[model samples]
Target: MSLKFHRDKLSPLNIWPGFVDALTALVMVLVFVVLVFVIAQYILGTELNGRNKAVDELNQEMNRLSALLMRAKQDINQLDAEKTQLSEQVVTFEETIESLQSQNMTLSTKIESLTSDKANAAKAKMSLEEKMAYLQSQIQELMSQLKLKAIAIDQHKSNNQVLEEEVASLTKKLKSALNSEAIKLANYKSEFFGRLKEALADQTDIIVVGDRFMFQSEVLFDSASAELEDNGKEQLKILAQTLKKISKSIPADLNWILRVDGHTDKRPIHTKQFNSNWELSAARAISVVNFLAQQGIPTKRLAAAGFGEFQPLDTTDQDGDYNRNRRIELRIDQR
Candidate 1:
């Protein structure tokens, strides 16, 4: 039996030892592969850590950029607000300029109107001055004429007194011839008036009223003055020459007189020279008598009288009537 078992083990089907050796070799190879895989894993972990650090740095840079953008937007908004306020101020300035222009135009028109009115007033004043000058000239002309009439009368009165004495002596011698002489004297008086009228025919201011020669006061005298002017002296000289011729032809016994009567308007006078209209009229008549005496007229043949504000040719209360009421008259009458 022992010999049969030993022979079975030694047979070719006894592969147990060889199988254990192969299994041991396969286990060693698996160990080597596990070591290689552990080394590769360690290298991959190190590379991943470096990539994570780079990503964190990139995220911080992006946040900083976003903060800068927000600041830029805020600045833009502030600028827009300021621009709107400036535009409103510019509009206000334009309105003020327009109002000032309107006011300037209104002032210009007012100045032009005032200038026109001033020119018109100046023209009116010039015209008034011209009219006043004309009126003054007229008054001066009237004044010169009045003075001559007054002077002529006084000269005649002095010559008449000498003639009166001669006539009285002649009358006593011609008593029987008185009636015929009276008739002759009456005829002579008419002839003398006709001759006097002829001598003064060219004078329109002297008017024959009844038996008297009437003259406007203004034609013979200045206002409130008895002084004779050059023109008045010339006129009185002519009258004195004519009267001397008439007196030589007349008979001295007739006792003829040339009555010089002065009249004044109702208007009263109170001046340094004259106290009233009565004094003015009386002075004018006396002035005439004095002038006639100076001209070699007979004093006895001249008579002076004054009527103050009593008799007037014109009755109405008018400026022209007042002028007409003032008069002077020459009349031939018995002394």
Candidate 2:
């Protein structure tokens, strides 16, 4: 069958050809569009697969960033804790500074008290020094008075020593004057005896011995009698005148005495006028003193003594010695 014949039976014969040509053209256009869509879909799928691989790599980077953010948060928390501790230390330092300022005020008050005590002590020391100066002046005055007393005592001792020396000088002068007077008296006695010896030189019955003139008792008196004979009285007158002449030449200050001593022989005698030789001898001495007084001789210058047989001139018991023992002696001496 022909195409035109199949078309006539289905459609009107006049429009069938145009419609068939249009439908065929439409189917060719649909087939070309479908082919272009399939090629576009394959190219899009290949690009999608590359984009998926890049997305997986981005997810792994985001996970790493999240872990780093968690660690940064922990560090911020530790920094906050340290800032709190530093704030507490600053408050404690402020309290310590306030306590030190209070102690400085207390020490300042103690130093002011010490300064006041030092001023009071200086005033007391000055007052004590003034009192010591007054006491030293009083001690100096007492020492001056003691020195004046010592000088007065020394002067008194010097005067007493001078008076003692003057008294000793006067006593020595008196002793020297007495010794000169005694020597002059002795010279006068020696001159008087020498004159008596020259006057009686030719008379054998009269002899001079030492400082005395000795005469035999028989020449002056009778044996065993007290009376002076005539010749004895004449001889005594001559002796009295001689002594008177010599005494006038002597110094009046020299008071001299003529001593008459009568001695007897060793013989016992008993007579009516005498009991023994001692009485006879005494009477003979007294007779001679009385005769001299009558011859113008001073009685004050005459003295008499008597000696019996005890005054013998010769110790042998013989007649010649007995005659010599019986004698009268005159001596001149100081009264």
Candidate 3:
């Protein structure tokens, strides 16, 4: 009985814990296999979805291509119709031209024969005396026409001369009257009246300076400020309008030059806008030029220069001579 008891203890019932552990291990292995299968299914499904999207895009592109092909076919049909119309018109025009050419050749032959008969008749009938009389009559007619044309030409020239004289007289009288007012202002001593040629001298501003109509710098602009005053702007407006008309009369092919020179007082100007009298003078000159440009003066014919304190009409740096350095000079030339 004792041996049987020991055998029972050694049997399967005593090793039940070992059997349970082995069963649990086998169940865990099965669960791991199921997890791997689930992950593989998800990956395969994602790949299929991506392939489906690519196919849809390809189909859309094909639809667009098919539409473009249809439009191309329509354009080709239109071109074919136009080509056929042009070909038919060309054929019809060629046939008409050929028919006209045949008729023209026949008429030309008949005209040549008739012209020859008429020329022979004329030659046979024309004696030297008759020819001389015909020539004399022709010459007389030509002389009469030429005399009339000459008379007309003389009349036109006379009219033109009178008109030019009248224009000159009017302009001179206007300028002379303004000069009288300027002469009153000339009492400033530093201020120059009349034209600016005297102040500008041989500079580019005075292309041709006449001594009789000359005035110094102060007649044209403000001292050290190239800006034209109201009085100065008005003077320039009249001059510019007059000169524009004069320039047009000279001929369309001619070009002229007009320059403005800005002279400044001796006082220096140091600021953000102007560094010295040079800049001030230049700005003033530019102002006058711009003012003239607004009055229909062509910018292509305009130029501005700054003389600074160098172009003093009074030749002195005295405060009283401040007016002498301010000038806007106008010049003209044919180039």
Report lDDT per candidate: 0.68, 0.72, 0.58
lDDT of 2 by residue, 1-335 (tens): 69989887897448888999999999999999999999987887787566556545555544554454445444445444444443444344344434433443443444455676555544443443443344345444434544443444344344434534443444444445446556776677777777766777778999888878888999999999989999888778778978888887665555688999989998899999999888888889999999999988889989888887778889898898999999999998776
What is the full ranking by lDDT, best candidate first?
A: 2, 1, 3
Top candidate on TM-score is 2
Question: Candidate 2, 156: how far from true, in Å?
Answer: 16
lDDT of 3 by residue, 1-335 (tens): 99999998887647888999999999999999999999987987787577556545655654554555455455546545654554565555456555545555554565567886665544433443354455456556645655564565455456545545554555565456446534533322112223343433444422333311222445555443444567666656666666565555332223445666766667777877788888877787688778878999789878888877776767776766665445455444333
Cα lDDT of candidate 3 equals 0.58
Off by over 4 Å in 2: 1-175
Q: Count of backbone clashes for each model?
A: 33, 0, 1
Cα lDDT over the full model 1: 0.68
Q: Report the Cα RMSD per candidate.
A: 75.4, 93.0, 35.0
Task: Give a tens-digit lDDT track for model 1, residues 1-335.
Answer: 99999998887876889999999999999999999988866776566556455444445544454454445445445545544554455455456445544544554555566786656645554554555455456445534544443343344344444445444544444443446556766676676667778877887767788777776777668888877656666666677777888887775446788788888998889999999888888788777778888999989888998887887888899998998778777777764
CA displacement after TM-score superposition, residue 220 of candidate 3 (Å): 6.1
Error of 2 at 144 (Å): 25
